[model samples]
Target: MASAPQQSLPLFYNDLQPLSSQQHADFKIRSADKAPFLAKQHAVPVTVEEFPLVQRFMPIVFSQGEEPVPLALMGLNEGINTFFDEDGSLNEPNFYVPAYIRRYPYLLARLRPDSDELSLCFDPTTDTVGAFEEGEALFVNGEPSETTKNILQFNEQFEQAGARTGQFMKELKELDLLIDGEVTIQPDGAAQPFVYRGFMMIDENKLNELRGDQLRKIVQNGMLPLIYAHLFSLGLMRDIFGRQLRQGKMPEPQLVQPTA
Candidate 1:
């Protein structure tokens, strides 16, 4: 299994604090009309629960590194998210936003390193969040309000999904199914085809070599569909590459220097 991505605080998270009545009794999470936060992100973390819906629009791929997580590709290259426009607003209004993005500001994190306890915390740096004179109150009369409870429930579910994703990754790794991924594309008038590497993908050849009992166990475990979903989504790589090419977002190919 890919080593878990180095455990670090996610993006936009700074000065996390547990939701407290004394600290944020009158605070509310304002409704934002758009998601400018995701504008610059080319890939976003997702889970098995989201695979069925997410596979339709974006190519689902695993992130490269020790801790490999499922990623929904918004663009073929880094820092290029085709889903959002110049203002960071989503171009496709109907596109399904990943729960990881929707659960922004609120995340379950360990407050202390000494123990394994996790706390529900929010990012104070987000402009959309904070103590407000009005809107939805996080705590009313020193008790969590309905909105707060709902957010907590959603975050819990998200955490659960994360656990399942970890198990899925473990299974893939144990099966030795993941291998280095590469894709080649040729533009209509280009002199040469472009090849992309550095990412990891499921090895179909290895999958085909699994024993009958192994295949039965995987099928019984309900992992077969998820594996198929991942394989099917790879077909969209060309679409994404083309989208970037047509939108003029493709970056210049890297040139390797000769070694002495």
Candidate 2:
């Protein structure tokens, strides 16, 4: 999918690829489907359920280890029960089904925060933006379900998984290149349903759809190779005394109080 030219937002403090500090502040890129696809952060389970509606059929469990089967199985039409639990003490078997994770390795996105006691549950393939509590489950008969505070807040799966949504995420982290990083669609009268390649804008209006997830696809697909460079502050600087001077800090500066 080709991304249109859009106005990029000013850098946010958290997403600027934070420096690795005292384990309190550190960042690394995880593959959504690649190693660097996800920003660095610890994830844990806030909720785990047996989603029967998620699978196609009840399959046999082939295992020797005494592990509880995964509560969430991929490609299964039958749904599973989801237990909402969070505490450092919770074990993988307490929340996760070994069978499910085995079938779908990327099913869960775990994260732990130093300030919170709860783990966040996320369906990496279909989880919506913001908190997972607000999102809904994937339905067997049709599409995935999610709750939204506003209609405006939603992940619209366009283009028939023109890239299988799950497959895309898994491969992105591993692949070195995309056939074309960006694309352009003229929508000519001569041809119908034309798909373009590479990051060329179809029009300016499409830029309104820009979101964090889309940004990742664009970057992985080759639209923005050096997109990282634009995310840092040109003026914000850290001082010798652990002071952050927001205004442009240069090697030479003015001493207002007259240095001794």
lDDT of each: 0.79, 0.22
State the lDDT of candidate 2 residue by residue for 142-193, as single tens digits. 3222321111121112112222433432343333221211222222352433
Ten residues in a row with the worst lDDT in model 2? 233-242
Error of 2 at 249 (Å): 60
State every prediction's TM-score relative to the real structure: 0.91, 0.16
Clashes of each: 6, 48
Tens-digit lDDT string for candidate 1 (63-92): 777778788888877677788876778887
Give lDDT for model 1.
0.79
What's the lDDT for residue 101 in model 2?
Answer: 24
Q: What does candidate 1 score on TM?
A: 0.91
